[model samples]
Target: MHQIKSKLLLTGAAVIVAFSFGLNANAARMDMVDVSNNNGYMSTAEYVSMRNEFGVKAVTVKISEGGTYKDPYAASNIANVQAAGLYINGYHFARYATKAQAIAEADFAGQTAKAAGLPVGAVLATDVESQEANNQTKTTNDRNNTAFMQEIAKFGYRSDIYTSGSWANNKMTIKGKTGWIASYPYVATGKNWYSTNHAWQWSSTAKFRISYGGFDVSQLNSTYYTADQKSSVKPTDPSAVHQNNQTANKHQQANSSAKWVKESKTYTLKTAVKLRTGASTSSSVITTLPAETTVKTDQAIIQGGYRWVRQPRFSGYGYLATGPANNTLEYVKISVSNTYYTVKSGDSWWSIAQRNGLSMYSLAHQNGKSIYSTIYPGNKLQIN
Candidate 1:
């Protein structure tokens, strides 16, 4: 089965399931619900109702910790969300000094989240920035975070990453994992995938009363997901489809003319648009995009009285319907050289360099890490 993703630029039509809803509603929330152990332990029958009443369609529950300790109240909180029939998700607070530590924590987090009722289509994220780089270089710390995310992916769930925008851009290896950006006051655009924030977390306010404690609310923008992904946990191993194409290349938007007539193009959405499963309007909506959304396409097709742009894989939704005559999605910039590698167990700088036919010093220097430093399994390495 295809992997469930929550990234800005996922590749492949069958593998992407993300949420890309921007165009904020002033001060109101326009996305999912994310709570934690800090929200207190309560078994309120209104857990689901209150969320539904507030327009909450999904819930992100904290399951594991920055270390190995499980969230004390995660099970109860998860049960309430599950019992309430809300979409289920979970995250781990990362606290890793080594690649091994990150994997162990990811294993613990995945197991805990699974037992606590994490659903199939739901995402498991590594909450970085908590001791993410205690004594190590930023590269080492980023490897840990990437390893944590990769280990979580091994358990069958799609992976996401949570951290500040500055940290993500300047300090971490954020290629493989989809971004769940935390930026207060919400920045409209950044260096990541979206022109705006993808899965933007707007606040940590304690104003919303939930169950036995207060909950934090967030907003979704420039990202979206599908219902099948939100379904209960299943036996489908997303690793089945794992490859270099799983994540979008930040260096280049690959494969134009595969869908669109052009190789790299851009467009804007004037209205809320839906990606249809087929070229016809009557086809099922694959995903929905917010207004003013900007996306890149290499192809377009005319059908159902609408001009549909072929979506680059992992750009969240596919086949964006552009009605605004001014709407245009084109490629703007390209990086120097986009090269990467996913670390495997027992792999190190020397081994990676030798295997890839790269010089040890060059590889280390390219990734901004020392040759003597530790590289974790599941983290993606920038080769050149």
Candidate 2:
């Protein structure tokens, strides 16, 4: 079967079943699952759910494709899976037709896998079901496939070959290497179809009620995770993922050097505005402040073609734009304070001036009244 995948972008879903354990004739075998960016960002809870709800013993994440594309979610997925107490490995989609090309692609895949934190000596399988390989002669395909796996071996990783059962039986002869054969039966009961291979990918449309979509799944034999292989283990709290994110956000905030003018002011938003992490339109948004919301700002800065105002927060500063750099078409501005007040029974010029931040003489003069003028509650006075 030809498995088409986007060369650089995340697409589809597949699971590689893997586990590392000592070789024992009586050890109960476990299944492997594969994931790529198409699985989205898996949380530790989700990984735990997969383990508890569906019995996913181990995971193999797609690490890289071709020579230049590294799967964006590979590192995070590896970490989450490990944090959830599952063994982890990595795989790369291969596109090489010659020995030299295989070596080059293997080098790229090996380095990318390492950078993504796949433990050294974990199974690094080359997914060789691309259409480019189907067009090459069997000799060419086998020779270069061996070259690819051999090159990755130099990087201290155990190697395997992932291909369709038909390809393994017909088009390619990856002899002596562990095989991960993909063959979707009418019903995937986790039964091993290719008995000689180390792993059997029994279904590409396997779905569990706990997961949102279908996935490719495999049934792995003990050799897929032999005693010699290094397996991923939980090194920190799974919640540390969120902590790292918070730290990165702090780092991003610290990177800005905008000079803010401090002034306590309140403004009413004229339109919905984005609260950002930084003083730029391109910065990541924290939230959206709805129209007519009143917000207090302790500082403001002009940057990135906008007037950004800082709303002091206990965690850090959240910024929103007042308007464009030219200060036209404003989204928010200083709320108008009362300019006129009605005289109360006990109100005096001095009391009015103190409340309005004005001098007694200025308040009385603005209101056309003497400082000692007797006023009733209904008399209007210009407090400004």
Per-prediction RMSD in angstroms?
A: 22.4, 24.0
Clashing pairs in 2: 14-34, 15-33, 15-34, 16-33, 16-34, 17-32, 17-33, 18-32
Residue-level lDDT tens digits of model 1 in 1-384: 226654312111121222323222223342465776444554645554444334444567788875557877787776776666555667887767799998988888888877876765567877775423423577887778778877887776767777765566555755532577654432222323322443655444223323432244455543333233333322133232121112211111221112333324444555456666655444677766665666666665432223456676664446655531111111112223355889999887767764443446556766888666688899898753
Top TM-score prediction, candidate number = 2
State the lDDT at 216 in candidate 2.
59
In model 1, what lDDT does residue 308 have?
A: 59
RMSD of 2: 24.0
* Candidate 1 structure, TM-score to reference: 0.49
> Which regions of candidate 1 fall more than 4 Å away from where they truly are?
1-24, 27-30, 132-134, 175-177, 186-197, 209-214, 222-384
